[model samples]
Target: KEILLLLVADMKAEYIPPREDVIMQNESPDELYIIVSGEVEMLESEMENEQTVWTFKSGDMIGEVGAFCCRPQSYTYRTKTLSQLLKIRTSNLIEAMKTRQEDNIIMIKNFLQHHKKLKGLRLGDLLHGVGGDYGDPNMYVNLLTVASTGNAT
Candidate 1:
């Protein structure tokens, strides 16, 4: 919370009503949002189907990956309820990180730890994201098998 406060102290805050899109799929947003209140749902739209990939609430950082990697948002985020958010442009976020190297590393470590603990799976499941993003379920399963047993070919 302190870290987020520091990051957002100089940024503008926005209020979004329920069901409004925060991050649109296929549109690259150069900013990351720190949710101050309310819920946001992350959705992935493929063809005519839109799937709920995740839901984030107060204190959660949305669009971190895009902000960190400078890539287009792969999912769309919409408010599930009335929301209050602090927006930090990617350039500013990067600059802040650069100025606070130790804190930034800790933040990155926390994110990695969160990913490791995600969905209650072991190390094997970590690689599932790689395949899932590429639309290859078989590859995920295969990679899980390999990762779990420490087998390589």
Candidate 2:
């Protein structure tokens, strides 16, 4: 899937005020969020106590692990400041996945593995499908080019 265009075409942009939870820990996962502005805090609940695990800022994509895996959200994501996010419904992604062949599954799996080290805006930048200073534009171009040409080298 062309996640950038898919998000632009299929997601909804929402503005969230500060100190509000975008999603709560253990909530039923429904959508993936891409941070467009401001910061978000990721928290985990343990024995009724919440602990901050990580912080996501503009350009970060969150809630995908649970949504893509069809599981409950593992952490709470709250706005640390005023924020804007693009929300992609899990149902949309599932529908898209259903239309793809087996190779797309592997491609998505590899894509997930490749994205593990990326964070926040940098990751978001890559997902936008636009070449930027933070990520190599050629990577996406090359990947698509190869796929289109039926070459896997």
Candidate 3:
């Protein structure tokens, strides 16, 4: 279905200078980014401290989970060197996906798999309590309420 062409139709290329922060921890993802060049560092932030937990290079993608699931990303990403990135706004991608049901389903599956890999990365103790569960502690309650109330609520 040429998902790349569908996504690229409304894509924006970003040129980020060294040390620029591209994504921040706990912020809801609005866009998905594919690294085109240079380097990006993913940082784990807690309290007032932040540390680099991973480094992303050309061809790596970020914000897939947040863009697909409308959740917050657990790590913050910043450019470590001059970087070129291809960005796709969530709204645009969703709009295109709606036109092709099969492709949309496959894309969502891929995003979920990508999220799983992020969690499985070997970090051990540093990852004891890190990752996607950073959503609202009350979100589950709201979801249950919606389920009981009705999907139209």
Q: Could you give the C-alpha RMSD of every candidate to the true structure, in order shown?
A: 6.7, 10.4, 6.5
lDDT of 1: 0.69
1-153, model 2: which lDDT tens digit per residue? 464455458889999999899887767778989899999998766787887767888877788755654445657889999999999898877666566556455646554654665645333332332334425544654554454355786
Off by over 4 Å in 2: 1-7, 106-115, 118-153
Q: Rank the candidates by TM-score, best first.
A: 3, 1, 2
Clashing pairs counted in every model:
0, 0, 0
lDDT of 3 by residue, 59-134 (tens): 8887765665466676788999999999999888888888876676666555445544765463222123333455
Best by TM-score: 3
Task: Extract clashing residue pairs from model 2.
Answer: none
Which candidate model has the greater lDDT, 2 or 3? 3
Candidate 1 lDDT, tens digit per residue, 5-84? Answer: 66767688999999999988756658888899999998878888987877887887777655654446767899999999
Candidate with more favorable, higher lDDT: 1 or 2: 1
Residue 99 of model 1: what lDDT? 70
Off by over 4 Å in 3: 112-153
Residue 77 lDDT in candidate 2: 87
* Rank list by lDDT: 3, 1, 2
